[model samples]
Target: MLNVDGLKNGIVIDHIQAGMGIKIFNYLELDKVNGSVALIMKVSSKKMEKKDIIKIENVVDINFDMLGLMDPNITVNIIEDDKIKEKIKLSLPKKVENLIKCKNPRCITSIEKYIPHKFYLVDEEKSEYRCEYCDEAYKLEF
Candidate 1:
């Protein structure tokens, strides 16, 4: 095992799917942070064969909903005073708006351009999201 410096306060995002770690890193603007940031990819996991972890030092606020869309299985640890303060289990959002553009050609968002793409969760089990304007169904897939 490698020794990692403990952070005073920040976030530790674990359980990221191996290659998708960088995707979330960019999505969350973690790479652009001036504070300490560490991204570990393809680390050993007991539950998962492989996983990725991201550590941000001195970060106070983070958008968890976007993180969930980037990778649904991610685990978040709130670090305080070099200790694990809290553990957050992320879940797919009930609804997503303007995050994903409707791919359908005839979709209202595509035609209107100005109107934001909005979707409502229709099925949590099936991960189905339906567009309010065009009725286009989008499956929430990472």
Candidate 2:
């Protein structure tokens, strides 16, 4: 077995959707970061088919909006001196603006260039969101 050391004074994003790791990584700009960062993607998990785990050492000021877009089930673990100091459990916000561009061409967001794309949660159990203007349906997975 390989030994993966713990992070010191940073964060761990867990419970990410299997293939959305790169999207989250790009959205978070983890590649351009200067600090020590580790992205272990598609790791086997009993709870999930595959999961992505990102460890960033000595970093804060995370982007919440981009995180929400990638995976709503993501959990932020804050480590201090290589010990778990804090945990941030996030819930899917009922409404998200501007983070995602509506795919529906008929959607108001796609039609109107100025109006911010707004989506409201229609089904929390299924993680479904609908456009407020054009009634476009979107299923956002965890």
For each candidate in turn, the TM-score is 0.86, 0.78
Q: Estimate every model's Cα lDDT from 0 to 1.
A: 0.84, 0.80
Top model number, TM-score = 1
RMSD to native for every prediction? 1.9, 2.6
Write one digit per residue (lDDT tens) for candidate 2, span 1-90: 645678768889888777777777777788888788888888898889899888888866886766865677788899888788988777
- Scored against the true structure, residue 102 in model 1 reaches a CA lDDT of 90
Q: What lDDT does candidate 1 reach at residue 7?
A: 80
Cα lDDT tens digits, model 1, 13-51, are 999999998988887777678898989889999989999
Estimate candidate 1's alpha-carbon lDDT, on a 0 to 1 scale.
0.84
- Model 2 residue 95 distance off true place after TM-score fit, in angstroms: 0.8
